[model samples]
Each structure stands twice: as structure tokens, then as C-alpha cells.
Target: MSTNTTDIFTIRAAPGTDIWRKPPTTNICNAPTAIPPSTRSTGPLTSFLSACASFSFPWRERYDQAGILLAFRRRSESSDSGIPPKWIKTGIEFYQSQPQLSTVATDTWSDWSVTPLLSSLPGAETEQWTTILVEKSEDEHGKSIWVYRVVVDEQTGEEKSRTALREICWVYGLDGEWDLEVVAMAARPEKEVKDGEEKELVVKVRGWEVKWEE
Candidate 1:
């Protein structure tokens, strides 16, 4: 099989920019507005197979994050209850003064998980680039989406190892009436710049790949 990779690009996320949903009417969807059209992929939910990307950014301040986002929205206008779309975002986030692999899945509400970056892993010291893959998978029980932290070779950009981070089963149930959009995303939830500050979080994306159904 052949593989495709995009050239390096940057995404600037303003302060207080985030993508989150919560109970009792808390929905924030202000992060992807900065993304360029060339970096986004959209299709029917059933047609989406997988999405992968490599991201790097300077870790500064609280609630800073950069990663791959998979968003799903209902296709029919009547089925839409005027609610926010379901989404999954996985990547490296700045927490506890360090970078950690984090994943957040949103259905009716948002749930988050985080894992430490082990020192033994490749490129863990510099905390430069982190690769994440979100793909469709199935087991005897049912269909699901798997989130993986992929370690790639610095020289050849080939996969060296991958660790499973999360498995979301609820997402596939919406395939019958939903469309999917995948893109690189960045957010800074706690740092809003004041007047004339000119400060923003810039995330460097090394590459992005999306697989679709044949």
C-alpha cells in the first residue's frame, strides 16, 4: 500500500480557544477556525477509516494542547437538535508543567484521559514531535475507534512502536446519519491575551494522513 504525507504546517491558536462540551449547556467550538482548508478532510462517517498526524509545539502555560480532531455531525437537518457535534481529540497536552498524551471523547458529555510520556520512548526528551493515530476497528463484540500513540523513527519517519491509548465504541453508532471531519487542532484554554499582547500558541504539524473507504 502507498502512503501520503503533507508538508509541514503551523496552526496558531488564540488564548481561550478550545473545543469542548459539558453538561448543563457548556459548549465551546472555537479552535478550528484558524485551520486552513488544505489541512482539513471531510466525508461521510462510514467512508472514514483512519486519521494520523504528527504535532510539535512549545509547552507553555496551562491547558495548552495540539492534536488530531475527529468531529461528527448528523447529516439530516431535522435530526439535528441544535446541539454541538460529537468529537474526539488526541494529542500532546501541557499539564502539570509537562507534556502528556491526552485524549478527550465527547458524546453527550466530554471525558478525558492522559498518560505520561515515558523517558525510555524515542524523542521523549525534547518533547518535540508526537504522533497520534485514530482509526476504526472491530472486535467480536462490536465496532470501535482506537486511539494510538505512535513512535516514529527520526531519520526515516517509519513507525517504530505504537501504544494504545483509548477505545471509543459509541462513535460508530452515529455512522448511519453522520458525516465526519478530521483536522489538526490546537487550543489554549487558560491564556487569553490582553490588548496589544500579540501572544498565541503555535503548533507545528509535521504531517497528516487520512484513509477513506474504497
Candidate 2:
């Protein structure tokens, strides 16, 4: 069976770029809220089964991130509604002077989770690469989308381990009115460049794969 994969590429995120929605009752003042620009490849949401990617970037500032984003938009909805599409982004995020594996899901508001990388040490340089997978999964309760942190063997180029990071239960329905946009996204919400400074956060996506329903 053949597989669909993307070539190695980079995504440059400027200052003030982010993809997030704050919850009600949470103060939006002093927070950066904007849809971060992304490089996208889209397909029918019903045809999407799974996606995985391996990526890395230098960790320098708070909220520096790069990873896979799954965005869903209803076909019949108009842009005039002023509603943002539901989305999930999973990847490496810099926080507390270290790099963490992070995931965010947004339906009405955004919820975030982060954990230290299993192979990393405090104050050590960031890992050479980090891999993640997002896929539709089911258990006895019902259907849902699952996110996983994947560990790969460097010598053999095979999967070494997989750890579940999050389970998103509300993304399973919509009939056929929704389409999916899979994106390679990066963001730096707090790092502003000075005048004449050309520095930017560039994330290197080494590998990307998406599987569709057959």
C-alpha cells in the first residue's frame, strides 16, 4: 500500500502569531489572540483517518511552537458568521525555559496540555526531532480523536514507543458538512524583532504523512 507524505520544509512564524481562543470568564486583556498563519493541505473531513509528522525547532522564547494542526470548518457556514473553525494543534511548545510536548483543542474555547519530553533534560539543548500522530480512534464508550507522542529508533528508523497525550471526544460528528485542513504550523506569540532585525522562528518539518479512508 502506498502512503502520502510531504517533503521536508520550513515554516517561519513572526512575532505576535498564534492560534488560540480564550475561554469565557477568562480575561482576554494582555493575551495575544489571533489565528496564526499556516501552510495547509486540505481534504474532506469524512475521508480523513490519520496524520503524523516529525518536526523540530530551536526553543528560544515563550510559546514557540511547531506541529500538526487539524482544522474543521462546516461547508454551509459563511465567513460572515464571525466564527472560527474548530481546531486541534499538537507539537513542541517552549515554556518555562524548556521545551514541552503540547496539545490544544478548540471547540468553543481552547484547552491546553503540556508535558516534558521523555528524552529531554532540564537546561539541555532541545531534542533533534519530535514526532506526533493524530488519528480517529474508538473504544467501548464511543468514537474520538486521539493524539500521541511517538518515539522513533534512530538506527532502525522504526517506532520505538507511543504515549497517548489527549483524547478529543467532541470532534466525531458533523455528518458531511465539514472539511478538514491539515496544516504545518508554527507560532511565536511573544518574541518581537527589533527594527532592522530579521530573526524569525523557523520550524523544520522533516516528515509528514496523512491517511484517508479507502
| Top candidate by lDDT | 1
- TM-scores, each model vs. reference: 0.87, 0.82
Off by over 4 Å in 2: 1-3, 24-39, 78-83, 121-127, 174-176, 191-198
lDDT of each: 0.79, 0.74
Q: Compute the lDDT of residue 182 as modeled in candidate 2.
A: 74
* Clashes, model 2: 0
Give the C-alpha lDDT of model 1.
0.79
- Report the C-alpha lDDT of model 2 over 1-214, residue by residue, as the tens digit: 1134546677787787778788554322122211232334666776788888888777777888888888788876523324346888888898888888999998878899999875765463455688999988978998899999999887786898999999999887656578777767788887565567445777888667777776
RMSD of 1: 3.6
Q: Write the per-residue lDDT of candidate 1 for residues 130-183, one digit (tens) a residue.
A: 889999898899999999999899898899999999999998776458887788
Instruction: Tell me the spans in candidate 1 whose CA falls farther than 4 Å from its real position.
Output: 1-4, 77-83, 120-127, 192-198
Which candidate leads in TM-score?
1
Query: For model 1, which pairs clash?
Result: none
